[model samples]
Target: MTQGSARTDLRIGQLNVAEGPAFEEFYEIFCEALPASERKPRELIVALATRSDYYLLIGEIGGRVMSFAILYLSDRYPIALLEYLGTSAAARGKGLGAEMFRAAIDRIGSDSLVIEVDSDRQDSGDLEMRRRRKQFYARLGARQIPGVEYRMPKIGADSPPELDLMVRPGGGRTHVTKDEMAAWIEDIFRGAYHRAVPREELARMIQAMPSHVDLIP
Candidate 1:
């Protein structure tokens, strides 16, 4: 997809291979935009691009890569996880992030897209930055899924970071049922995390979910 305006002309699409200049450019921005704790090893990320269910979307302008998004499509569920998204420092403040997000959703064509954001409830990092990130998604129609504490799967030896799970419902939906949310979570734990998360831990998290999860602003 392509979006053109006075300030930017962005062309976004999926990158199937993990090599070449575009992939290299995407990786450069990925490493720079996301902290070590929040990202997986370079090899593992590259491997995911080879999978049928995973998509690596890249956005560029005038043939220069400037942004990317990693989307995980669950085979057993009608949901996709927005695993990682980043815009190069040089491309910041040009509304590329939001455009990339919408392009990802459009490419996946899923009824729901789940994203993980740093939690304000915990001192994960810069609180103000976290607030701004949440607000950014909010403006794009994503809302927090309250009553549950969400965490990213552990990267290497580091413990998982607490994050807020927000969902953007498509097809004119307003909420997700408990069962649907539970399945999506389990799919994420198994498909996306490759069952790296312990079964007992997964059970505990699901057990704490509310019956009806309303996306709240």
Candidate 2:
């Protein structure tokens, strides 16, 4: 079913992931905007879309596809993970991305929505780009969790990518401590990303994280 919102011109709905020409084109465009590692093969995304825990939302403006968002609902908690969000090249600089984000939050009905942002890295030269990305989310009301340190698993021998955790907590969101947050974050890595975090590695990551509960203002 197509969902409508009066606040914007874009119409949001689920992407048809069935094997077909239209889906192929849509996925191709979406994948082009993302990194090679982040872009999954067609078969995997097709299977994921059929699962109850995953959602694929597309936003179209005047019949033109403009943005897409993938969300995952955790099996252990009533939390939604904003797995990936991207906008068509032509649609950048407009407010479509932010609108799509707010729509995802509204549709999921989850008070706490978690998003992973790449942390500044010395080897990677896109420090300003990374900062801008996080700022965009912050402007949309998402707050970075203080003291959280996340490292993305190595992709094909490249260094283990580091990331930061941010969340937009709605009215019914529960207040969790550092430990609880770490567990939830780990659950996302294991459940959504399918990466097993060893006990020792988990301990190390948690140790690197701050124990404070402050939110980015």
Candidate 3:
């Protein structure tokens, strides 16, 4: 499950357990790269790694952990969600992020992979960084799932932030049907978010989806 050329020395694989030095290293990188509002508690992350459907992909080089991806594979849906992906600050610009992304997709082995990115419409001060993030994923072949007003589930005391849903469609697929999108969202909310999101909020988001969701370039 690891991927790398001899020249790069990169290695990517799933970290099945939430204990020990490896898990601690991964957690360090995770906490360093993500804001508290965007991260799950360490205990919850540990608990999730024990699930059959969760794949915690950790990337390393020369035995040092550098990147990670949190993937949720849902048995009830054909799509998988890439909930979080990050590279250590020192690992940036070395292509580890893209490598981790590919590893997550390979692990999912699904025709569709969903991702949530901060919406440009939000007044978050990091607009420039958000734009670059969207561009990064776009460069990696993801297309925005237009017409759905996506938002993250509330965490702690922070309000949910607006997000844009993107899909990396496989098998030459170009779009998703309304029903398919709704089902995927439901699966993501229940399985990935663990239903931390209220049922009414989920329904409202699903209702906002268009009949045909085009992958906008």
User: In order, what lDDT does every prediction score?
Assistant: 0.81, 0.75, 0.80
TM-score of each model, in listed order: 0.89, 0.87, 0.90
Comparing 1 and 2 on lDDT, the stronger one: 1
Question: Tens digits of per-residue lDDT for model 1 on 27-84?
Answer: 8999999878888898898899889989888888988889999989888877889999
Encode model 3's per-residue lDDT on 1-217: one tens digit a residue: 4666333688888885634777888999999987777888888899888898888988878787888999888888677888899999998997888888878777777458899888897677999999999998999889877667777776656675788888998756777887787778877878877775566766676676678876645
lDDT, candidate 2, at 110: 51
Over 1-217, each residue of candidate 2 has an lDDT whose tens digit, in order, gives 4688654577888887663654665686678777765566567778878889888888877776678888888888767888888888887888878878988888778557889888764457888989899999999878887656676665443454678878887655535467877778778877777888776767766675566564434
Candidate 1 regions exceeding 4 Å error are 1-8, 16-19, 196-199, 203-208
- Model 1 gets an lDDT of 0.81
Instruction: Order the candidates by lDDT, highest first.
Output: 1, 3, 2
